[model samples]
Target: MKMFMLKSLCLAAIMLIAVLTGMQLASSGIQKMKGYEDPNLETAVSFHEKDNNVKASILGNDISSHNIAAKKKKLEEISAFNFFSSMGKKLSNGITSASEKLIQFIAD
Candidate 1:
């Protein structure tokens, strides 16, 4: 049972690492795609000026601000989770190393 649990834990760690790596890769890819500056700023502004609705614009800005706040909170949560996960990984590695050393000493 202990061995099974260890195997399961290791599998979970591997899966987590893979998922994090994939997310990093995907984010980097998106960043790369965003390297170019938007070339239609004047055109966009002209279009917006043509159909300017004050109330709707204010509502849209409010919604955008809310979305930004939500995304910021989610980013913070993800950062905290990442920190804890990394600490756990380091602790597990230290324990594993200490156990292996103790086993070697006992054998000798």
Candidate 2:
């Protein structure tokens, strides 16, 4: 059924997002900030700015789970966030696909 396929896709998207977020957080040596600094992070469909906590809507369409990282990345190809890549600097963890693009974009 079409509904089943939609549900499966939705679940897959959610899992993918979770895995990405988890990996980003689970890396060693790179102290993870609670959140990255981005003044351009737009108002979220469900956001509140209080007590230094920002809850906002980010990337992804309504049909699927929203990917905040992807949302933060929209039009961010020219940003300064990419220069300080800690990826591959350590022997254990390697670079991520996103970090590669960030490096390339920064180099360009």
lDDT of each: 0.64, 0.56
Q: Can you write out model 1's per-residue Cα lDDT over 5-71, one digit (the tens) per residue?
A: 9999999999986875676566556656779544431111111333554221321233345677999
Best by TM-score: 1
**Model 1 worst lDDT run, 10 consecutive residues:** 41-50
> Which residue ranges in model 1 land beyond 4 Å of their true spot?
36-108
Best by lDDT: 1
**Can you write out model 2's per-residue Cα lDDT over 3-97, one digit (the tens) per residue?**
99999999999998787566545542133343554455422233457798665543322322245567667758656654346443542244566
Candidate 2: which pairs clash?
Answer: 44-56, 44-57, 47-55
TM-score of decoy 2: 0.28
